[model samples]
Target: MDTVMQPDVLVIDDLQKHFGGLEIMRGVDLTIKQGERHALVGPNGAGKSTLFNLISGEHRPSGGRIYLRGQRISGLKPEQISRRGLTRSFQITNVFSRMSAFENIRIGVMARHGIRFNLYRRIKPMRAINDEAHALLQQVRLDHRADNLASDLTYSEQRALEIGMTLATGAEVILLDEPTAGMSRDETAYMVELIRQVTEGKTLMMVEHDMSVVFGLCDRISVLVYGRILATGTPEEIRSNQEVQSAYLGEEEEH
Candidate 1:
C-alpha cells in the first residue's frame, strides 16, 4: 500500500528578520498544508505579525526564504506576491469607507481580472464584474448591506466586507491578521463561522489571541515564542504539549 501526502501550500525556511539592532524573527521555520486553516498563537512581541509581513511581502526578509507552493517569494513586492495567489487582511478593518459594500468588493474582483481603471473604461459595461461582486457580497453574508456605505455598516459587517474583498482577489492562500479583534463574543462567533464557510477549499493562516476561537476553528496550531516556533500540531496535540503549555497557553489561562 502507498501513502498519500498533502502538498505544502506555504513554507517558511529558517526565516530571519532584523530591525536595526533588534532581531524580530530569528530563523523561524513553519509550513502550512494545502486547504487547511492554521493558527499562529503567541504572546505580544512574539514576531507573529512580522512573520506574516515577511510572508506577505509587506516587509522583506533579512535572511532566508518564503515559498508559495514550490516557488520562491522571499524578495517579491507585496502586489507581486498577491498576483501569485497570496493575499492578506490587516488587523485594522480595511475597506473603502466611501464605497458601498458592493463597490468595495468589486474593486478586488476587477483587480483579479486585470481590469485597470481608466477614464475611458468607466463607460464600458461591467456586468460580469458586478455579478461576481454581488455573489461575493452574498458569500460574506452582507448582501443586505450591499448598497450601504462601508462606513455605515456595523463594525462586524465592516470586517465581513473586508473579508469578502480579500476573497475577491481569487487568492489561494489567505492570511488574516487578528480577524476577530475587538468584537463582542457574538460578533466573534459570527466571524468564526463566516471564516469557516468562506475559507473552505483554500488555505488560511491567522494570528489570533482568543483561545476558544483558535481551538475551535483551526485544524492545526503553531505556537510561536520569542520569534521562534516552539510547536506545531493538531489542536489536541498542542493542548497536551508541556512546553507549549508552559510557554504560552498556560500564561493565556492565567490572564
Candidate 2:
C-alpha cells in the first residue's frame, strides 16, 4: 500500500533578504501544503513579518526563489501575485473607512473581475457582483452590518470585514499577519473560530504570537528564530520538543 501526499502550494527555497548591510532572512526554507492551516511563530525581531512581505511582494527577495503552486513568483508586483490567487491581510485593519462595509467588499470583487469603477457610466447594475459581495459579507459574518460605514464597526467586526475583503479577491492561498493582535481574550477566541470557519477548503499561512490560537486552529506550526526556521511540527510535537522549549516556547511560558 502507498500513502498519498498533499501537493505543495507555496515553497520558499533558501530564501534570503538583505537591507543594505543587514540580512533579514538568512537562507530560509519553508513549504506550505495544500489545504493546510500553518502558523509561523517566533519572537520579536525574528523576521516573521519581513518574510510575509517578501512572499506577498511588498519586498523583493535579495536571493533565492519563491514558488506559488510551482511557478516562481518572486519579484512580481503585489497585484500580480494577488491575481495569481494569493492574497494577504495586514496586521492593521485595512478597509475603506468612509465606505459602507458592502462597498468595501464590492471593490475587491470588482478587482477580481478586472472591472474598473466608472462613476459616469450609464450601465446596468452588476447583479452577480452584488450578489457575490453580499454572500461574502454573510460568509465573514458581517451581513448584518453590510450597510454601515467601515469606521462604525467594532474592532473585531472590522477585522472580520477585512477578512471578507481578502476572500473577495477569489484567492486560493491566504496569508494573514497577526490576525489576533490587540484583541481581548474573548475577541481572540471569536476570531480564531471565524478564521477556522472561513478558511475551510483554503490554504492558510499566518504569523501569530498567541500560542492558544496557533495550537487551537493550526494543523502544523513552524518556529522561526533569528531569521530562520528552527522547527516545524505538529502542536503536540512542538509542545514536547526540548529544543523548542529552550529556544522559544520555554521563554514564552516564563513571560
Candidate 3:
C-alpha cells in the first residue's frame, strides 16, 4: 500500500475585502506543499496585498477559510497566527529605528521563545534567546552589524535585518511582501541569494513585482488581476501565458 501526502497548507476558500461595493477578492483557493516556494504577482489594485494580509492574519477575511497544517486559522490575530509557525515581513521596513540591530532581532527571538512579556526577568539572563538571535543574524549575513543601530544600516542591510527578525521568530511558513523593494540591482541580487538560503526547507509565499526575482526564486507563480486569480503556473508557463501577457506583461512593456 502506498501512502498519500497531505498538503501542508491550504487556503480552502477566501473572499477578502470589498471597497465601495467592489470586490477585491472574489473567491480564492490555494494549496501549498511543504517546502514549496510560491509567488503571487498581479497588476496594481489586483489585491495581491489583500490576499497576503488575509493569509498572514493582518486582515480578517470577508468570507471563507484559511488552514495551516490542516488547522483552521481564519480570524486569528496576527500574533496568534505567528505563534502557529507562520510569519510575515511587510512591504515597508518595520524595525525599531532607535534600537541596535542585535536588539531588534533579540526582541523577535524573545517573542518566538514566548518571553516578550517577562518584564521582571533580565534579558541578559536569556542565553538561549541570545544564541538564537545571533544565529538568525548570521543566516542573513548581518551579524557583523549586530551592534549598529537599525537606522544607521544602509538600505540593503536594513532589509537583511528585517528578514533576520522574521527568522528569529522560528516560523515554518514565511510570507514576504516585496522583499527586494527599494533595492539596487546589486542589492536585489544579494537579497535573492539570502532569501533562498534562509527559506530552504520551508514554505515561502511572496507577493513580488519584480519578475526577475519571481522567476529566480519561486517554484510556482499565481497571477492576480481585478481581484481574482487569473492563473497559476510555473515561472516558464507564466512567462509564455497569453492571458498573463495581455493582463500584466503587455502593460509593463508599454510603460
Candidate 4:
C-alpha cells in the first residue's frame, strides 16, 4: 500500500521575470496544494503583484516555468489560464461601478457560461443567469443591495462584490492580491469571513500585508522579499522563524 500524493493545484518552478535593464523576479519557486489557504506576505516593492501578474498571464516570465495542476501554463493567455481553473483579483476594486450589483455579477455569470460579450441576443433572455446572479449576491451577503449601484456600496462591500465576481467564474484556484489592502479593522474582519465562506473547498493564494488577516485566514504562509521567497511555513512557524523575523516580520511589527 502506498500513500497517494495529491497534486498541487499551482506550481511556480524557479520562475523569473525581468525588465531589459533590471531583473524583478529571481528564481522564485512556490507550490500550493489543493484546498489550502495560502498567503504570500512581503514588503512593498517585493514584487508580490508581479508574481501574481506572471501567474495570471498578465506578464510572461523571463525564464523558468509555471504549472497549473502540473500542466505547463507559462505562455498561455490570461483567459486561457482562467478557463483552466485559475482566477485572479486586483488590489483595487474591480466591479462595474455604475452598474447595479446584479448587473456586475451577471457579466461574470456570462463569462462562466462561455458567453461572449458580442452575443447580446442570447444574454438578454437568460433566466438562469439572472437567478445565479441573485444567488451570488446572497452568498456574498449583498442581496440587500442587489439593485443598488456598485458606487453606492461601501469599500468593504465593493471588495465582497469583487469576490463574488471571482467565484462566479467557477474558478477552483483563486489568486487574490491584497484583498484587504485598504480596509479598516472591522472591514477586514468582515471580509475575512466573507472570503472564508466564498472559498470553501477551493485553493486560495493571497498576497497580503495585514498580519492579523493572514494569521487568521491562511493555513500556510510564504514570505517574499526583494522578489525572492525567504520562507514558507505555517502561521506558527512563520511567527517564530528567526530569519524571517529579522528579514521581514520584525520590520513590519515595529510599525
lDDT of each: 0.92, 0.92, 0.86, 0.89
**Candidate 4: stretches off by over 4 Å:** 1-5, 117-124
Error of 1 at 251 (Å): 0.8
Estimate the TM-score of every prediction.
0.96, 0.95, 0.94, 0.95
lDDT of 3 by residue, 1-255 (tens): 010153556554656666668788888877776787889999998998888898888888888888988898889999999999999998999889999999999998988888856878788877898888888888888889989999999988888898888888889999999999988899999999999999988889998999899999998899989877888888889999999999998999898
Better of 1 and 3 by TM-score: 1
lDDT of 1 by residue, 145-181 (tens): 9889999999999999989999999999999999999
For candidate 4, write residues 1-255 as lDDT tens digits.
010145678889999999996888999999988888999998888999999999999998999999998899998999999998899888989889999998888888878888875644766567989899889999999999998999999988898889998888889999998999888888889899999998989999999888999999999999999889999988999999999999898897798
Q: RMSD of candidate 1 to the true fold?
A: 2.0
Q: Give the C-alpha miss distance for residue 1 in model 3, angstroms.
A: 24
Angstrom error of the Cα, residue 99, model 4: value is 1.6
On TM-score, the candidate that comes out on top is: 1
The local distance difference test score of model 3 is: 0.86
**Pick by TM-score: 1 or 4, better one:** 1
